[model samples]
Target: MLDWLRVVRMADMEAVRWALVGMSLDTVERAPVGVRAAQLWVSRMLQVGLIDRARPAFRQGSVVWPKDTTSGRVPDLFRQTARHDLAVSAVSARYLARGYEWRRDRRPITRRDHQADGVAILGGQAELVEVELTPKTPIRYKAIHSNHGERLTREGYTRVVYLATPGACRLAMKEADRWLFRDVRPRVVAAPVMDARGAWSGEPDAPWAENLMPPAPPDDAGTPALWEGIA
Candidate 1:
């Protein structure tokens, strides 16, 4: 069932005939060769119990179902599914492991009326996190920083981080060094791109059960620095 489901999902097979037709072929995108190849592959696997033989039902006769048995010589349907699933899991784990308090868009946080794209709780208050692919001009970045800074100060959130892609991050650093070192600057934290391949490349670490938010900023420029939230 799992194997059938996997193939069904990957190839969009609705019925046994479709599954059989999909697995054979000279090329998946073309016909005849594609259909025949699928039929042969499915039939051969069924004969070997690499797939299950379903009980005959009314109208439909007995059908071959792919079974995900852990054998060295087997179709990789289940293994492929598991690999795809694990990649997604690894990315999610990286986010949670980094002390982010994820909330859906428009979800309200107590004490602040502002809803966000996503937020991380800093100092017990939700600070909106904006993940960007492009770098904003210094004026634009400063404006964003100030808005978040003032809001966090007023609402008692310690700071907010703006996790940007590598290119944008470099621009942010440039602006930080040039303009933000003197005056009111929001604590913007940027991290590296978490690609699908890199998601599972890190050490597995458990997330913190609880996190503490720091006290509000005293002045406009007195915001605390940003840190990599991962422990």
Candidate 2:
């Protein structure tokens, strides 16, 4: 079951934003139940560190490029990127709490091609992260990601993370990383959070598999004696 679910994956960014977009659409359509459900799902994912708010640009860096350095559509691209970044940020924060040090929103090596979402460099760890908004088929997608895993490997980033929506090309990207860098993370996460409706409408039949609830507490007499001496 774990293997099966692993195959049915979602990037944290796309999962969170997809919920947001669905809720937004429901709200715009005046679907009250859908709106409430969407809100709940979004809230749940956020609370669990599956999604986070994007950081503001320019902690204090100078405006290195002209205002219009990128095409007009660039802002839109940034918006898309930011959504994914938020989810990745949430994941990074969780890892940080667990003693992993990471830097978010890293500046690009070049000002001309700076990315709004930015990459994360795990402290003293050979890992590089890049979040993707568009499907992998786009030319920009290729330009940004092509040989990235190999380059990162050469540069000592042992693993590269490519978070994106589910698609054939996206899957291929993961495979490509295997052939090129030999250090990419094995799994491309699919983080599809259930909407409120989706959550309520379904049965909790697979509780242990999902780890949705804590294991039942021990009896008042204390835990079973089966392992008492072992402890």
Candidate 3:
């Protein structure tokens, strides 16, 4: 919890709920007690001063880093892109539950360009994660893809994951095929961001999890045909 707060810097209760649900499954029904438990812990943290809280820009309350650190307020991270960052944090939490390493995009100030939301290491494969809440024009997408491809090649990332609505995901996959090189193109897979109503809730809609691990074989199965009759 401390690590997640440090990485995300500023996130509210709804985003916390999203993370809890994501860790259990893609549904809101699972792991609800966790959110309440987390809320209690957060309230206690407030008293202890291990973290600080600020009035939200979009959501209700969020904890931030101390004044000395960069990006010290909830409103600061959400001043312009509340929904986007919330989604990214929720996704990052889910990735954390899956034991993936997380790094928020803190591109240097000298380089001002479009940057991905975060990077995640899944099953030893580094992934560049982009959370798209809304679709953009093809010209804009072209530039974004170009940037992503350059980063993928330069930074040793294996795949570019586009998390968006189903339609947007399809567009991402199409653009990936159309734009990125054939060698790395196959690695791109679009996973729709599940339950993104208010807080940008995140859940792995099968394809993303399948990329990391295959399902186990059936239990207590019969012997193979070659050995079945021999016994």
Candidate 4:
């Protein structure tokens, strides 16, 4: 009955957990384990009845999930957009690269809040990561910023990080400016541009400067160290 459990490798288990939060085949393929290996693991999981796939409303590819997990009254991974799928994958890759472990809880911080796209833990720090692919209305963004800013601090998170495309980053920054008093302004980093192998195509040691607040000082001598330590 549990034969699928036996064939499951660490990577397979990780993939299933990620599916609980919704992931695309492309995202699963980008795991630290090489693409071919990840593909094999996902296929095996499907065969064993540990996971299922569904075509999201507007996406070209299907999203995956565990057989039947629920968050509140809703299915855990339902109707995600293509942009959301890519964002989740991109954020996951960055955290995985930084040696952070994915958290398993799928619940929201409070009944009034929504689940973050994903959470990563390293040492004593927990980071709530969000991928903003599209801009939310100004009112909606403010509500989100206010809710998360308060809850995250109260929950003892080290910081929140938002990995976003260039356009979305600008919108987030504008909202952040309004909520600066809440101190929930997340460290914003440009989502890494990756190739098919999941390897980043840009300069490895380049500082993450997109949407950086209080912009870096003009002179090299005075510029605050700008890298977010993500390598």
Q: For this target, which candidate reaches the highest TM-score against the unseen true structure?
A: 3
Best of the two (1, 4) by TM-score: 4
Ordered by TM-score, highest first, the candidates read 3, 4, 1, 2
Expressed as tens digits, the lDDT of each residue in 9-94 for candidate 1 is 22211133333333344332211224455466667766786665533222123334346576534333344343333232223223
The lowest-lDDT stretch of 10 consecutive residues in candidate 1 is 203-212
Report the lDDT tens digits of candidate 2 across residue range 1-231.
112112212223323323233223233211123445544654564566443333245111111111222342212224434344344443333333233334444456763343323333334543444444444544544445444544453555433444333342344354454453222323212222222111111122333213211111211122322112221
Relative to the true structure, candidate 1 reaches a TM of: 0.38
Score residue 198 of candidate 4 by CA lDDT. 23
lDDT of each: 0.41, 0.34, 0.59, 0.48
* Model 3 score (lDDT): 0.59
Point out where model 3 deviates above 4 Å.
17-33, 52-78, 106-113, 122-124, 194-208, 212-231
Full ranking by lDDT:
3, 4, 1, 2
lDDT, candidate 3, 63-141, per-residue tens: 3433333544334654566556666776676666555667876584344356677888655667778777677787777
Residue 229 in candidate 1, Cα distance off native in Å: 16
Question: Which 10-residue window in model 2 sums to the lowest lDDT?
Answer: 58-67
Q: Which clashing pairs does model 3 show?
A: none
Query: TM-score of each candidate?
Result: 0.38, 0.37, 0.69, 0.57
lDDT by residue (1-231, candidate 4, tens digit) is: 122222221122333333332323243222244445555666786798676655545433444445643432323343445345444654454454444555533676566676666667767666666666666788877777776666565766655555554455566666766874533443322343333322234332334522221222212222123323333
lDDT of 4 at 182: 30
Note the clash tally of each candidate: 10, 5, 0, 0
Residue pairs of candidate 2 with colliding backbone atoms: 9-190, 10-189, 10-190, 10-191, 37-196
